[model samples]
Target: MKVILVNPPIYDFSAYDVWIKPLGLLYLSNILKTHNIEVVFLDCLDRSYFETLVVKPDGTGKLPSTIVDKPNILKDIPLKYKRYGINKEIIKNFFLENNDADYLIISCSMTYWYLGIREILDIAKETLKQTKILLGGIYPTLVPKHAYLTFTNKVDYIFVSSNFSELFAYIGLDAKNLNFTNFPAPDYSHYKNLYYIVTRFSYGCHYNCSYCACRKIFPKYTAKTVEQFVNEVYTLYNQTKCKNFVFYDDELLNFTTTKQLFYEFLKLNLPIKFFTPNGLNPRFINKEIAKLMYELNFTDPRLSLEFTSDFTHDITDKKITFKEFEIAVENLINAGYKPHQISVYLLAGLPYETLNDVFHSLELLSKYYVRIRLCELSPVPKTQLYYQLGLDDTVDPLLHNNSIFIFNGVPGKVKPWCSYEELQLLKKFVKDYNESLKQKTIHSYAHY
Candidate 1:
């Protein structure tokens, strides 16, 4: 059997390279390959696309994009609507040339980026009239109802997870005798041209924050053993010669896992750089772990400090407490990391959170480190926050875009902590703080 895997493009006002990869699809690709099925990969967001634009000093760059008409639901928004990928003409040509596929599996990412899936599906249906297509990933897993409404009549099947037993049954494969005693790792051989790769050693978060939908989608908290991680990395580096690896774990620093992973990484002694893009829970950091991180060449120590004080933070769940956050800063500094070398993630534009709350959090963190990464709250389906706000699947997914929260909340329906003008002031404050830090001292830390 021959199959095709596709990573759809994204449509938004702004997008960035978070060292993103279709990890879920890669695992599924591995399963098909092990069954002796021919697999073809077409990654819309692949970094090596020749037409990619806005290349940056960092390995990450932008995809080739074109401005398009805004979705009917989002027409009034002032921001320009753009599609970040090859144009429809090029996409159609691709479909025409690569029409020899029996099954096509399309993967999705954020719920807000669902338009990309709709666009790709249109072309795939027209060019490959007899091909059967399936949809799976974050968008579908989190909001299956919406996925059904949009794609029920278009696609052959919609899978909530990678349960190949059901998927094989649909494809008429008698895999009843095939034993999945051990699943395979993500297949990245097709993406060998990437400069930086994303690696996830863990599956889900053990801690359930009310605002997060991780546990709902993942169902269980599973992790690969230390040996498994080391073996994957060793092979990846040798195959792609790509040294930059960003960990995409939702909770890599919970309990002793981060420290254990560090020891295993050190044993490899390979000339590679590691990073944790999903900010680490500061509560897990200690002198021992910090020292090991520096020795092992882990750059970009991002601390997850959602709010400044206990009162302002979500009290229902557990993460980095304010006290633990301070301890982590102290440990990182004493371990020889410079002030500018460390960064903190602060959440802004919460539904009821005030500018004062954000300012207070920023003040507590600014003294310790000069850089802060601000994240806007984008309520998603299946999260407590969404149900708390009475958000339904009927709502347009584009409203969940983080950038939209900067201007207004839910198209002027829900009230944010601060107004648009207030947000501008906050942005200015951050820019000034970062500028002053640059003038004061240069934190020359080796990254890479």
Candidate 2:
């Protein structure tokens, strides 16, 4: 049986090289390949792949994109809109040229990128009428109702999890008790020109942070064994000869399983550098863990201190506070982590957040002498915040963009209080703080 997995184009006004990858889809592809099924991938957002194909000017393929149209909602801003992959025609041609697949699986990321998913599904339907098109990933998981009501008529099936065994059964493949036993690592060989390797040592978060959707999406925090994780790391390093690694785990520092796993990794002392693009829970960082991380050769540490809201943070996730956060930072510093080596993530523009609150958070973090990475709050479906606010369908998904704090729109004794100008000023303050940190020093410590 043949399986074609496609990562649809992104329609956002701005994008970044944030070590993002459709890991779920890639994992599924690897599993299918292990069972002797034909697996193919078409990543639309990869610039290297796009350049190699040489996509044309008219959103068609053969060269890299030059004229990117600004997204509809974000057109008011001064940024170029882009369809970040190969040309639509090239994608179409690739589909038609080798279109003998029995099943076509498409994976989506951000919920706001649904338009791109619809476009890809439409093209798939046109190219191969006989094949069954399945949709999965974050979009389908968070908004199943929207997926069923809207795309049910369009796609044959929608799966939220990486459980593709049921689909395999329909195609006469025996997929019972498919244990992680001998589970294959992700297949990145097809996209050889890729720069970084994005992998997950664990799945989901134990803490239910109000602003995070990790719990809703991956309710159970499951992790691979240390041996399994290290084996994959070895294979990836050996095969790709790439030293850079990015962990996409939601809770890589849960102290229970992940910490122990990292301890084992530090023993290896491989000449490889590791990074965590997703922020780590501050509570898990103790002197021992910090020393282990340093010994393991972690080049940069990404610490997450969303806000100094104290125990009220428990309202969202019963995790994090100024006390524990400071202890973690101190331990990191004691273990030889320079202030600049640590990147702290601060959440700005919360639903009812005040400018004073954000300013204070920045000031507090800057006092630690660490570089602050400001992230806007992007509301995901099924989160407490999303349901509590009673978000409507009319709400532009772009408004959920973290860059602009749309929730803080009302000003005072009003129903939906916050001014756009006020929110902009807050965002500017965070940006200015980040820029200033590059030039200023708040603390000093030895580097790993």
lDDT of 1 by residue, 113-213 (tens): 99999989999988988788988888888888989999999899998763456677777776675332344667887863676877778878888887788
lDDT of 2 by residue, 1-448 (tens): 8888898887664565567678877787888887788988888776675344643221222324445565555655444555555668867886886589988888888877777787788788779877888888888777777777778988888876545565666666777856444457878877846566788887777778777788877767677788898889888888987666778888887756667787777776666777787888888888888888877877668888888887457666777887998998899889988876888887765655665677677777778878787777776667887766666444555555554435432122112224456566655665666666688743321110
Off by over 4 Å in 1: 51-58, 162-166, 172-181, 314-316, 411-413, 441-448
- Top candidate, metric lDDT: 1
TM-score of 2: 0.87
Candidate 2, superposed: residue stretches over 4 Å from native: 50-81, 169-172, 179-182, 392-399, 404-420, 441-448
Colliding pairs, model 1: none
C-alpha lDDT score of every prediction, in listed order:
0.77, 0.71
